[model samples]
Target chain A: MDPQSVERPPSVLLAHRMQGHPVLVVGGGVVAQQRLEKLVPTGARVTLVADHFTAAVEQTALQCPQQVRLVRERYRESHLNLEPYWRLILVCLPSGAANHSDDAKGQSKSESDSEKVYRDAKRVFGAQQSVNVADVPALCDFYFGADTSGCPTGKGEGQLGSMQLLVSSNGVAPRYAALVRDELVRHLGELPLAQSLDRLDELRAAVREEAPGPEMVAVRMDWVCALTDRLGLRGAASMDVQEELKKFKDYCKERGEQVKSPSQDN
Target chain B: MDPQSVERPPSVLLAHRMQGHPVLVVGGGVVAQQRLEKLVPTGARVTLVADHFTAAVEQTALQCPQQVRLVRERYRESHLNLEPYWRLILVCLPSGAANHSDDAKGQSKSESDSEKVYRDAKRVFGAQQSVNVADVPALCDFYFGADTSGCPTGKGEGQLGSMQLLVSSNGVAPRYAALVRDELVRHLGELPLAQSLDRLDELRAAVREEAPGPEMVAVRMDWVCALTDRLGLRGAASMDVQEELKKFKDYCKERGEQVKSPSQDN
Candidate 1:
């Protein structure tokens, strides 16, 4: 097998559009609703395929006008009317062949059964379309990343950071990835450098376009971040740091004062 | 509603037992094996319950000394009978509903009535153990977080400033937080702060045990981080500034370092 023929992992800022694509979301519960929420925002013409749905999914379906469609039955290969309408399909079912328990006790499906669904869904969606599963990593084109809203805006508006993906090189459990994702998230949230990067990205566009060179840009960013940390507690540290540096440089040039280096400033 | 009687969100830590406990990991596919990989290290007697398991789960069951119970028949509620042996159950099944596709497809009852098997299995597991279905947040006891395995020690260690929780207050989507986590992890990796924080934690323990006062400890830490950043930088700018500062300080000390005013430094 040639390595060049193998599939590649998705990177940040790939920006694929789902808008206006007739997409089918399989599964009636909250997971399906969550998937729909993301898909709808991307402008996918979503069709809900489930005999029953939670109130949230029903509400979402009602709100979307003609953009959303609902089916009133469990999934069948025939229901997957691969007519000209449906372009993308999202499988949001539980994996079966369960080692834990059976369904009457509200237990999950068997693992092989789950894999069968994954294989079936993948077959329907094919490689060209986005086939995402809510919790099943084995059948997903992409795992939804975590998003941060209401941060002071700069370059990437509504960008996601600090994400976790559920991928199976050998095709396996999505739930296990969930555990890893949660722990990584909590740990990353408190890191100081993550905060600094948030600030660094603000000036990244400016640096890319206007800086004398990449080295100077990198050095200037380092200096700016360091200066921001040196200053007393302030919100929007990056913007404030840049503004203060500009003011200081202007003051020094106007007054003919020798501008002291950071090391000597103390 | 009485404020005192109001229930708050439970703070639960899923402690992986050092001595190991019986953990029934449902689904006998790659995902089940993946769950087993994480569980075995914590010492869990893992039982893979599935009608059909993949080669990986089968191999893991064979290699591990922990009790491996494989039910090759279609799953039923009796599968949940390991209550005396297993208390914690992880449902990684592909779907929670009855597997009725075979009946619809005109398959024989003995060979294809998987839906009946699934329904019976679900009835035994109950809602608390039903984690496989999407939009079943109330059914789950824990949500997993992401991890970065790039640290030099291999063991996930180190702390950041403050306890930060990246929450979706409105519960729009949790995965978007991943993108934020990615940016943060990369940023934190670049900074000296995380390593310094680890050192600072050691100093903090010492200070808390022996320091004269908290204010003194705070001032000491403040100056330490400030000076370390200044000295750690490369290039002539840092060197020239440090040399100038040393000369100024020496000159002042040589002149008897007298402070005639209250605000002056000697």
Candidate 2:
């Protein structure tokens, strides 16, 4: 009814596989540290670009097993290019009066106005070219969703939980990101299933070389329903045809059978 | 780090909640019926422009609480612009020899390259917008993800179960959609918690107004943990803040205390 009310995609950000992408994360304050807390674990080649660093971020960076490059320098617009290597950027900084200063020379505007100007400058310079502004969706390409790292004792036991990307074509509010995360944390509270997903993934990988047939399909169906029930989802209980092939390896193991993924299936 | 190995988003066509957008859905078969099924529920104004209609679809459309206009006309390029409201188009018609013949005869081609032309035509013009073809991503904005509508009864009584959107930013193969859906279905199997998500949702809605402050937060944290632990999650339970607020309302009703939200906390 309203042209202004265009239906846009949900606010979501990609938690890309850290398999080997170089990602540049700007800023090094508490906010930046929060981003690292979630990013580094994903196996992304994370670089922290900032002149100042917090004790907590420094300490965490030091202990991190993954590649975390911390560069202490005043942020400039020239540093925005991390393409071909990095696919994502995150901007983390305090807003409004808290982000700027008042000089002895003279005052031009109020605290809030200065903060607004500083932020606008950052945007104008394209300093946030790859990064999504914290709490602001109109300036972001994605928003991070809440996710529980996989099980503590299963195949991906210690692996960081699968990151859920909640993208908003309409941009996401930082407050909303937190809300969505909190909501997701509440929604997918099942610990055992999280662990099971890991095991299933492992099982899928483990059984990839065995035989393939109708028996595998049947076993795969069982696991599909098992997962739906485990997650407290009712509609996902029905297993379709192709999914059985992907999980053929895992199902074979559960049934103590063996199967090879056919070239055709791939 | 492999620069070229970046994961590309799969193109997906979302059939849910088109809202009031003008869209065209091609075909009158079961698959078309399925797409329309989710669309109507979400309040999408749908028009099944097909010559043949499945009895199920006709009946379902007849029974839907929402208005789903059905146009029983043979598809034509001219028929496309016939709908005054069509904004987005989805092609789901059956295609092969006979359908291809109609299209081939309808268009003129060079005699020497007839076979090549026909093949190209099938790949291009003949490819239904709904087919999830290799290069059709440009024609779509979303993809149909695997959905577990919601748990109808038990603990997950009022919640939407696990929903997986198999999206391809490049829109290639519907098979991928099927594959991803299968994987999600297999992953969620039947579990006690799956049926209880709805109850959790109910509780969440029930407590929204209650602040997650000391007493309530502590209780919620404990309840979530207790439920997950009793249900097998280690410490991952989160409460529906809103649902908790509803409980507060009930608590207030019983004790004659005024209902206060987090704003009142300060």
Candidate 3:
């Protein structure tokens, strides 16, 4: 098939794993607070450097001590390299960030506080760093998803489940993407998605054991694809596990030559 | 609110823009082909290094010449330093990636081809670079979304338009996320999303002009949020622009103090 036949998007969307990764946020205002709120959920170890903190920001830092570390000091270039390397360097200062330090105020006059912070980060971290400035899309190495999809945060009991879904509009229409996510959460939240997902994982392990070896690699892939398409996550938990395994073996005996549609059989 | 009250996800999901950015892929087989297919859509300039290529992989490189460049040679350590720095270094090889180059084969025997490739990438690129090995989640810095959401590619006329929605399941259950994406595509693909977004931008510009000043920042934000909640992207295009602007001015007259619910007003 012609590659041109498939239209390409302008940017690639990826889920940056920040469970234990080091990230830097260099401001302490509402925007900083919002960024911190989002990052906290992703389990990132964010090191925030700001002398003054709003009541809300301090509360969050104090509560989620594991995820957030507060450094009550003004921004400094040394903060960029405090650790070996920061996975992401995010500056959440408002445009024209005030220069509270009177000593070094006259060195730069042309750029705003935002621009100064961005420039300092790039200069200190070099070209290898992925730095993002708040409200500045042009200088961003990546953009966070408008919101998370099927986050399972609202998935009863408020337990943070292992499963999460993120939705992005690629910066074209973030608000709309958030609306779409709200609708998805409405549909997905109602289902016992977490329970279904657990069951699906168990079924996958059984299938893997049943079809071992490189010779059965094709069989394994096809069966997995077919099962996912037919039952989705919900079916695994709802269906009889042993019965499904029997049916899978029967299909494998045929070498999966024909299209396997469990939906039809059901 | 207590930070522990809201549980955080295990990872942070983000959208990484790859347009015109340099990326290195260290294999050219089927797994490499899949990564290439995904990368091509993001407009990444991928430099693939491999002694051999699959037919499908060759076809893609030939078709999308701008996005892909072929290096007809085995992956060398020098490839890691080819440019200023690689945003992502991806190794796509089957496990126990055979040492095709036998001269150095005996140097490493315990590790399989997959493990070797992953090791080489980390050793060469250092900890600063985000390296990924295919099928190796433990070695990945980030994971791609299950599927793109509301991509305007399917929006009639086949023109790659701006505006898209992406959904991810935090790698907990990717297949389940893909199923969720299919549902999102079905609901969103039907709307005149791109055109509506254009209208929304125009409306936002008009609102910004009328409510110019830092004092009206709150008013601007609330009105825009209310507009999105009430009409969404579709309403921006469907409604009379002039009439909406007039109503917006009336709200500003009231200083936006009361809870402004455009849904009720509409």
Candidate 4:
């Protein structure tokens, strides 16, 4: 077996509240475009620095002028310095171009350049920053092998309430990771996990208003588990929301708890 | 609708080569244990700094003496100082405990304590490090919601070649994220994406030996795509590997290329 073919386990991290965080993205090719699409939804303040961008990336910039900033220039050490407090830097330059400078001395030069970018980001942001060098795993602090096909646009009330599923292969086979992710998306779509979660949220809120205690916390958890099982057995779409809510209220009432209807709270 | 229920997009990052990197995991609860299990596979040098340990975490430490260290104490700011090059810190204490000191001055105490941990980690490791304060989204620099149910052991040839799937919900709903992840794992088990990836790996090596060029790179990518489609249509376990290899060789031979068999390399 080839040593390169050997897969290593990955450490996965999910970043929340990237809104207004400065992100520096180098290269505007297909990979950069994909990264941008993922980043934009996070409400990140993204600045794309590439000598030339693919038509798709340019279109995305035009579409989200508030979120994405376009800087049409080749990557340089100065690019890292010129950022408005960048927290994450994504180098999406093609691997072929990077490998072109991979001879003994050429390798060090490219490696040093990549290292400098990471070092500079660290110096500026203080170890909270992450750098992803596309296709160059050795130079990257993080990898971007996420299959985000199931991600919902966080727009309006309904869309914001939906669940987002992301699968990462951690620099393993991209195609395989994508295949598995696509399959997961399909299976997850068939379940009423989202609806169940929404109901749980409502139930939890009602429980908190009525009786907030350690015991109630466990009760809420038990209720969620039981509801999940019921939803799993009977399709979520087929189940009546009013019936479920009524049953839930009845359960609380039996326990000598006064529960307000979720609709009443609104 | 509660503003907190609105889902925000997540920035997913996969860290590479975590071996020997110092990881500080606070709280030895089930969440901490789950995080440790995922961290151990990455070969991360972990230090579980908790007041106590779960039975399973203790067993894990006994099994992997070199990889995991037990602090056997409550989390303190000074704990970050005692480290062998800390890169990541996971705070897995229950949110209720974290929010216990959430009054006027009490809130500041806990917030400042959390802040100090993050600040100290950045000071020691620079901005390249990540800090995940479990359940407290406000205090965390990153969230740990990865469902690594399909990760391989990363030992020996066969185990090293398997794919790892991770799903993160970015702290929107942990239970929902886990439910979807479990469903995905079940569906992915039915696919032959991993086997197809192994075949692609062999094919890539053969291509590199015979026709190593930019053109070959594109050809390899195209071939992988075609093979993925074929594998999707045909059950991987039922399909004949020998026949597929023969067909692959014929396709390469048509382009005036000679390919070596994967078995021959072994």
TM-score of chain A, all candidates: 0.47, 0.55, 0.75, 0.71
Interface RMSD of each: 19.9, 12.3, 3.8, 3.9
TM-score of each: 0.32, 0.40, 0.80, 0.76
If you superpose only chain B onto the true chain B, what TM-score does each candidate give?
A: 0.45, 0.49, 0.73, 0.70
The numbered model that scores best in lDDT is: 3
lDDT leaderboard ranking: 3, 4, 2, 1
**Residue B176's lDDT in candidate 4:** 55
Clashing pairs in 3: A41-B9, A149-A165, A165-B168, B96-B112, B96-B113, B97-B113, B97-B114, B149-B165
Candidate 4 has an fnat equal to 0.35
Q: Which one wins by TM-score: 1 or 2?
A: 2
What tens-digit string does per-residue lDDT give for candidate 4 at B1-266? 32123345555445445756778887898889988887887878889987789999999999999999999977665677767456678877764454332232424554434455556666666544667765446556666554554333222223323455455555544555555555555555555555655665555455455445433555666675677556662244355555656566677877765455433443
Superposed Cα deviation of residue A243, candidate 1 (Å): 3.0
lDDT per residue, candidate 3, B105-178, as tens digits?
Answer: 44476454555656666666555567777555666777665655333335422321354445555554566667
TM-score of chain A of 3: 0.75
Per-residue lDDT tens digits for candidate 4, residues A211-240, read 454335556566755765556522443555
lDDT (0-100) at residue B76 of candidate 1?
A: 46
- Order of models, best TM-score first: 3, 4, 2, 1
Give the candidate number with the greatest DockQ. 3
Clashing residue pairs in candidate 4 (N, C-alpha, C atoms within 3 angstroms):
A126-B127, A127-B126, A127-B127, A127-B128, A128-B127
Model 2 whole-model lDDT (C-alpha atoms):
0.42
lDDT (tens digit, per residue) of candidate 1 on B1-266:
21111111211111121223455665676556656655554445677667779887777677775555666644444665754434345555543333433234443444323334334334454321212212223333334333222222232224322112122211112222233334444444443433433343343333323323322333433433454344441111123433333443444345444322212232
* lDDT of residue B79 for candidate 3: 65
Off by over 4 Å in 3: A1-9, A98-108, A124-126, A149-162, A190-192, A209-219, A246-266, B1-9, B98-108, B149-161, B205-222, B242-266
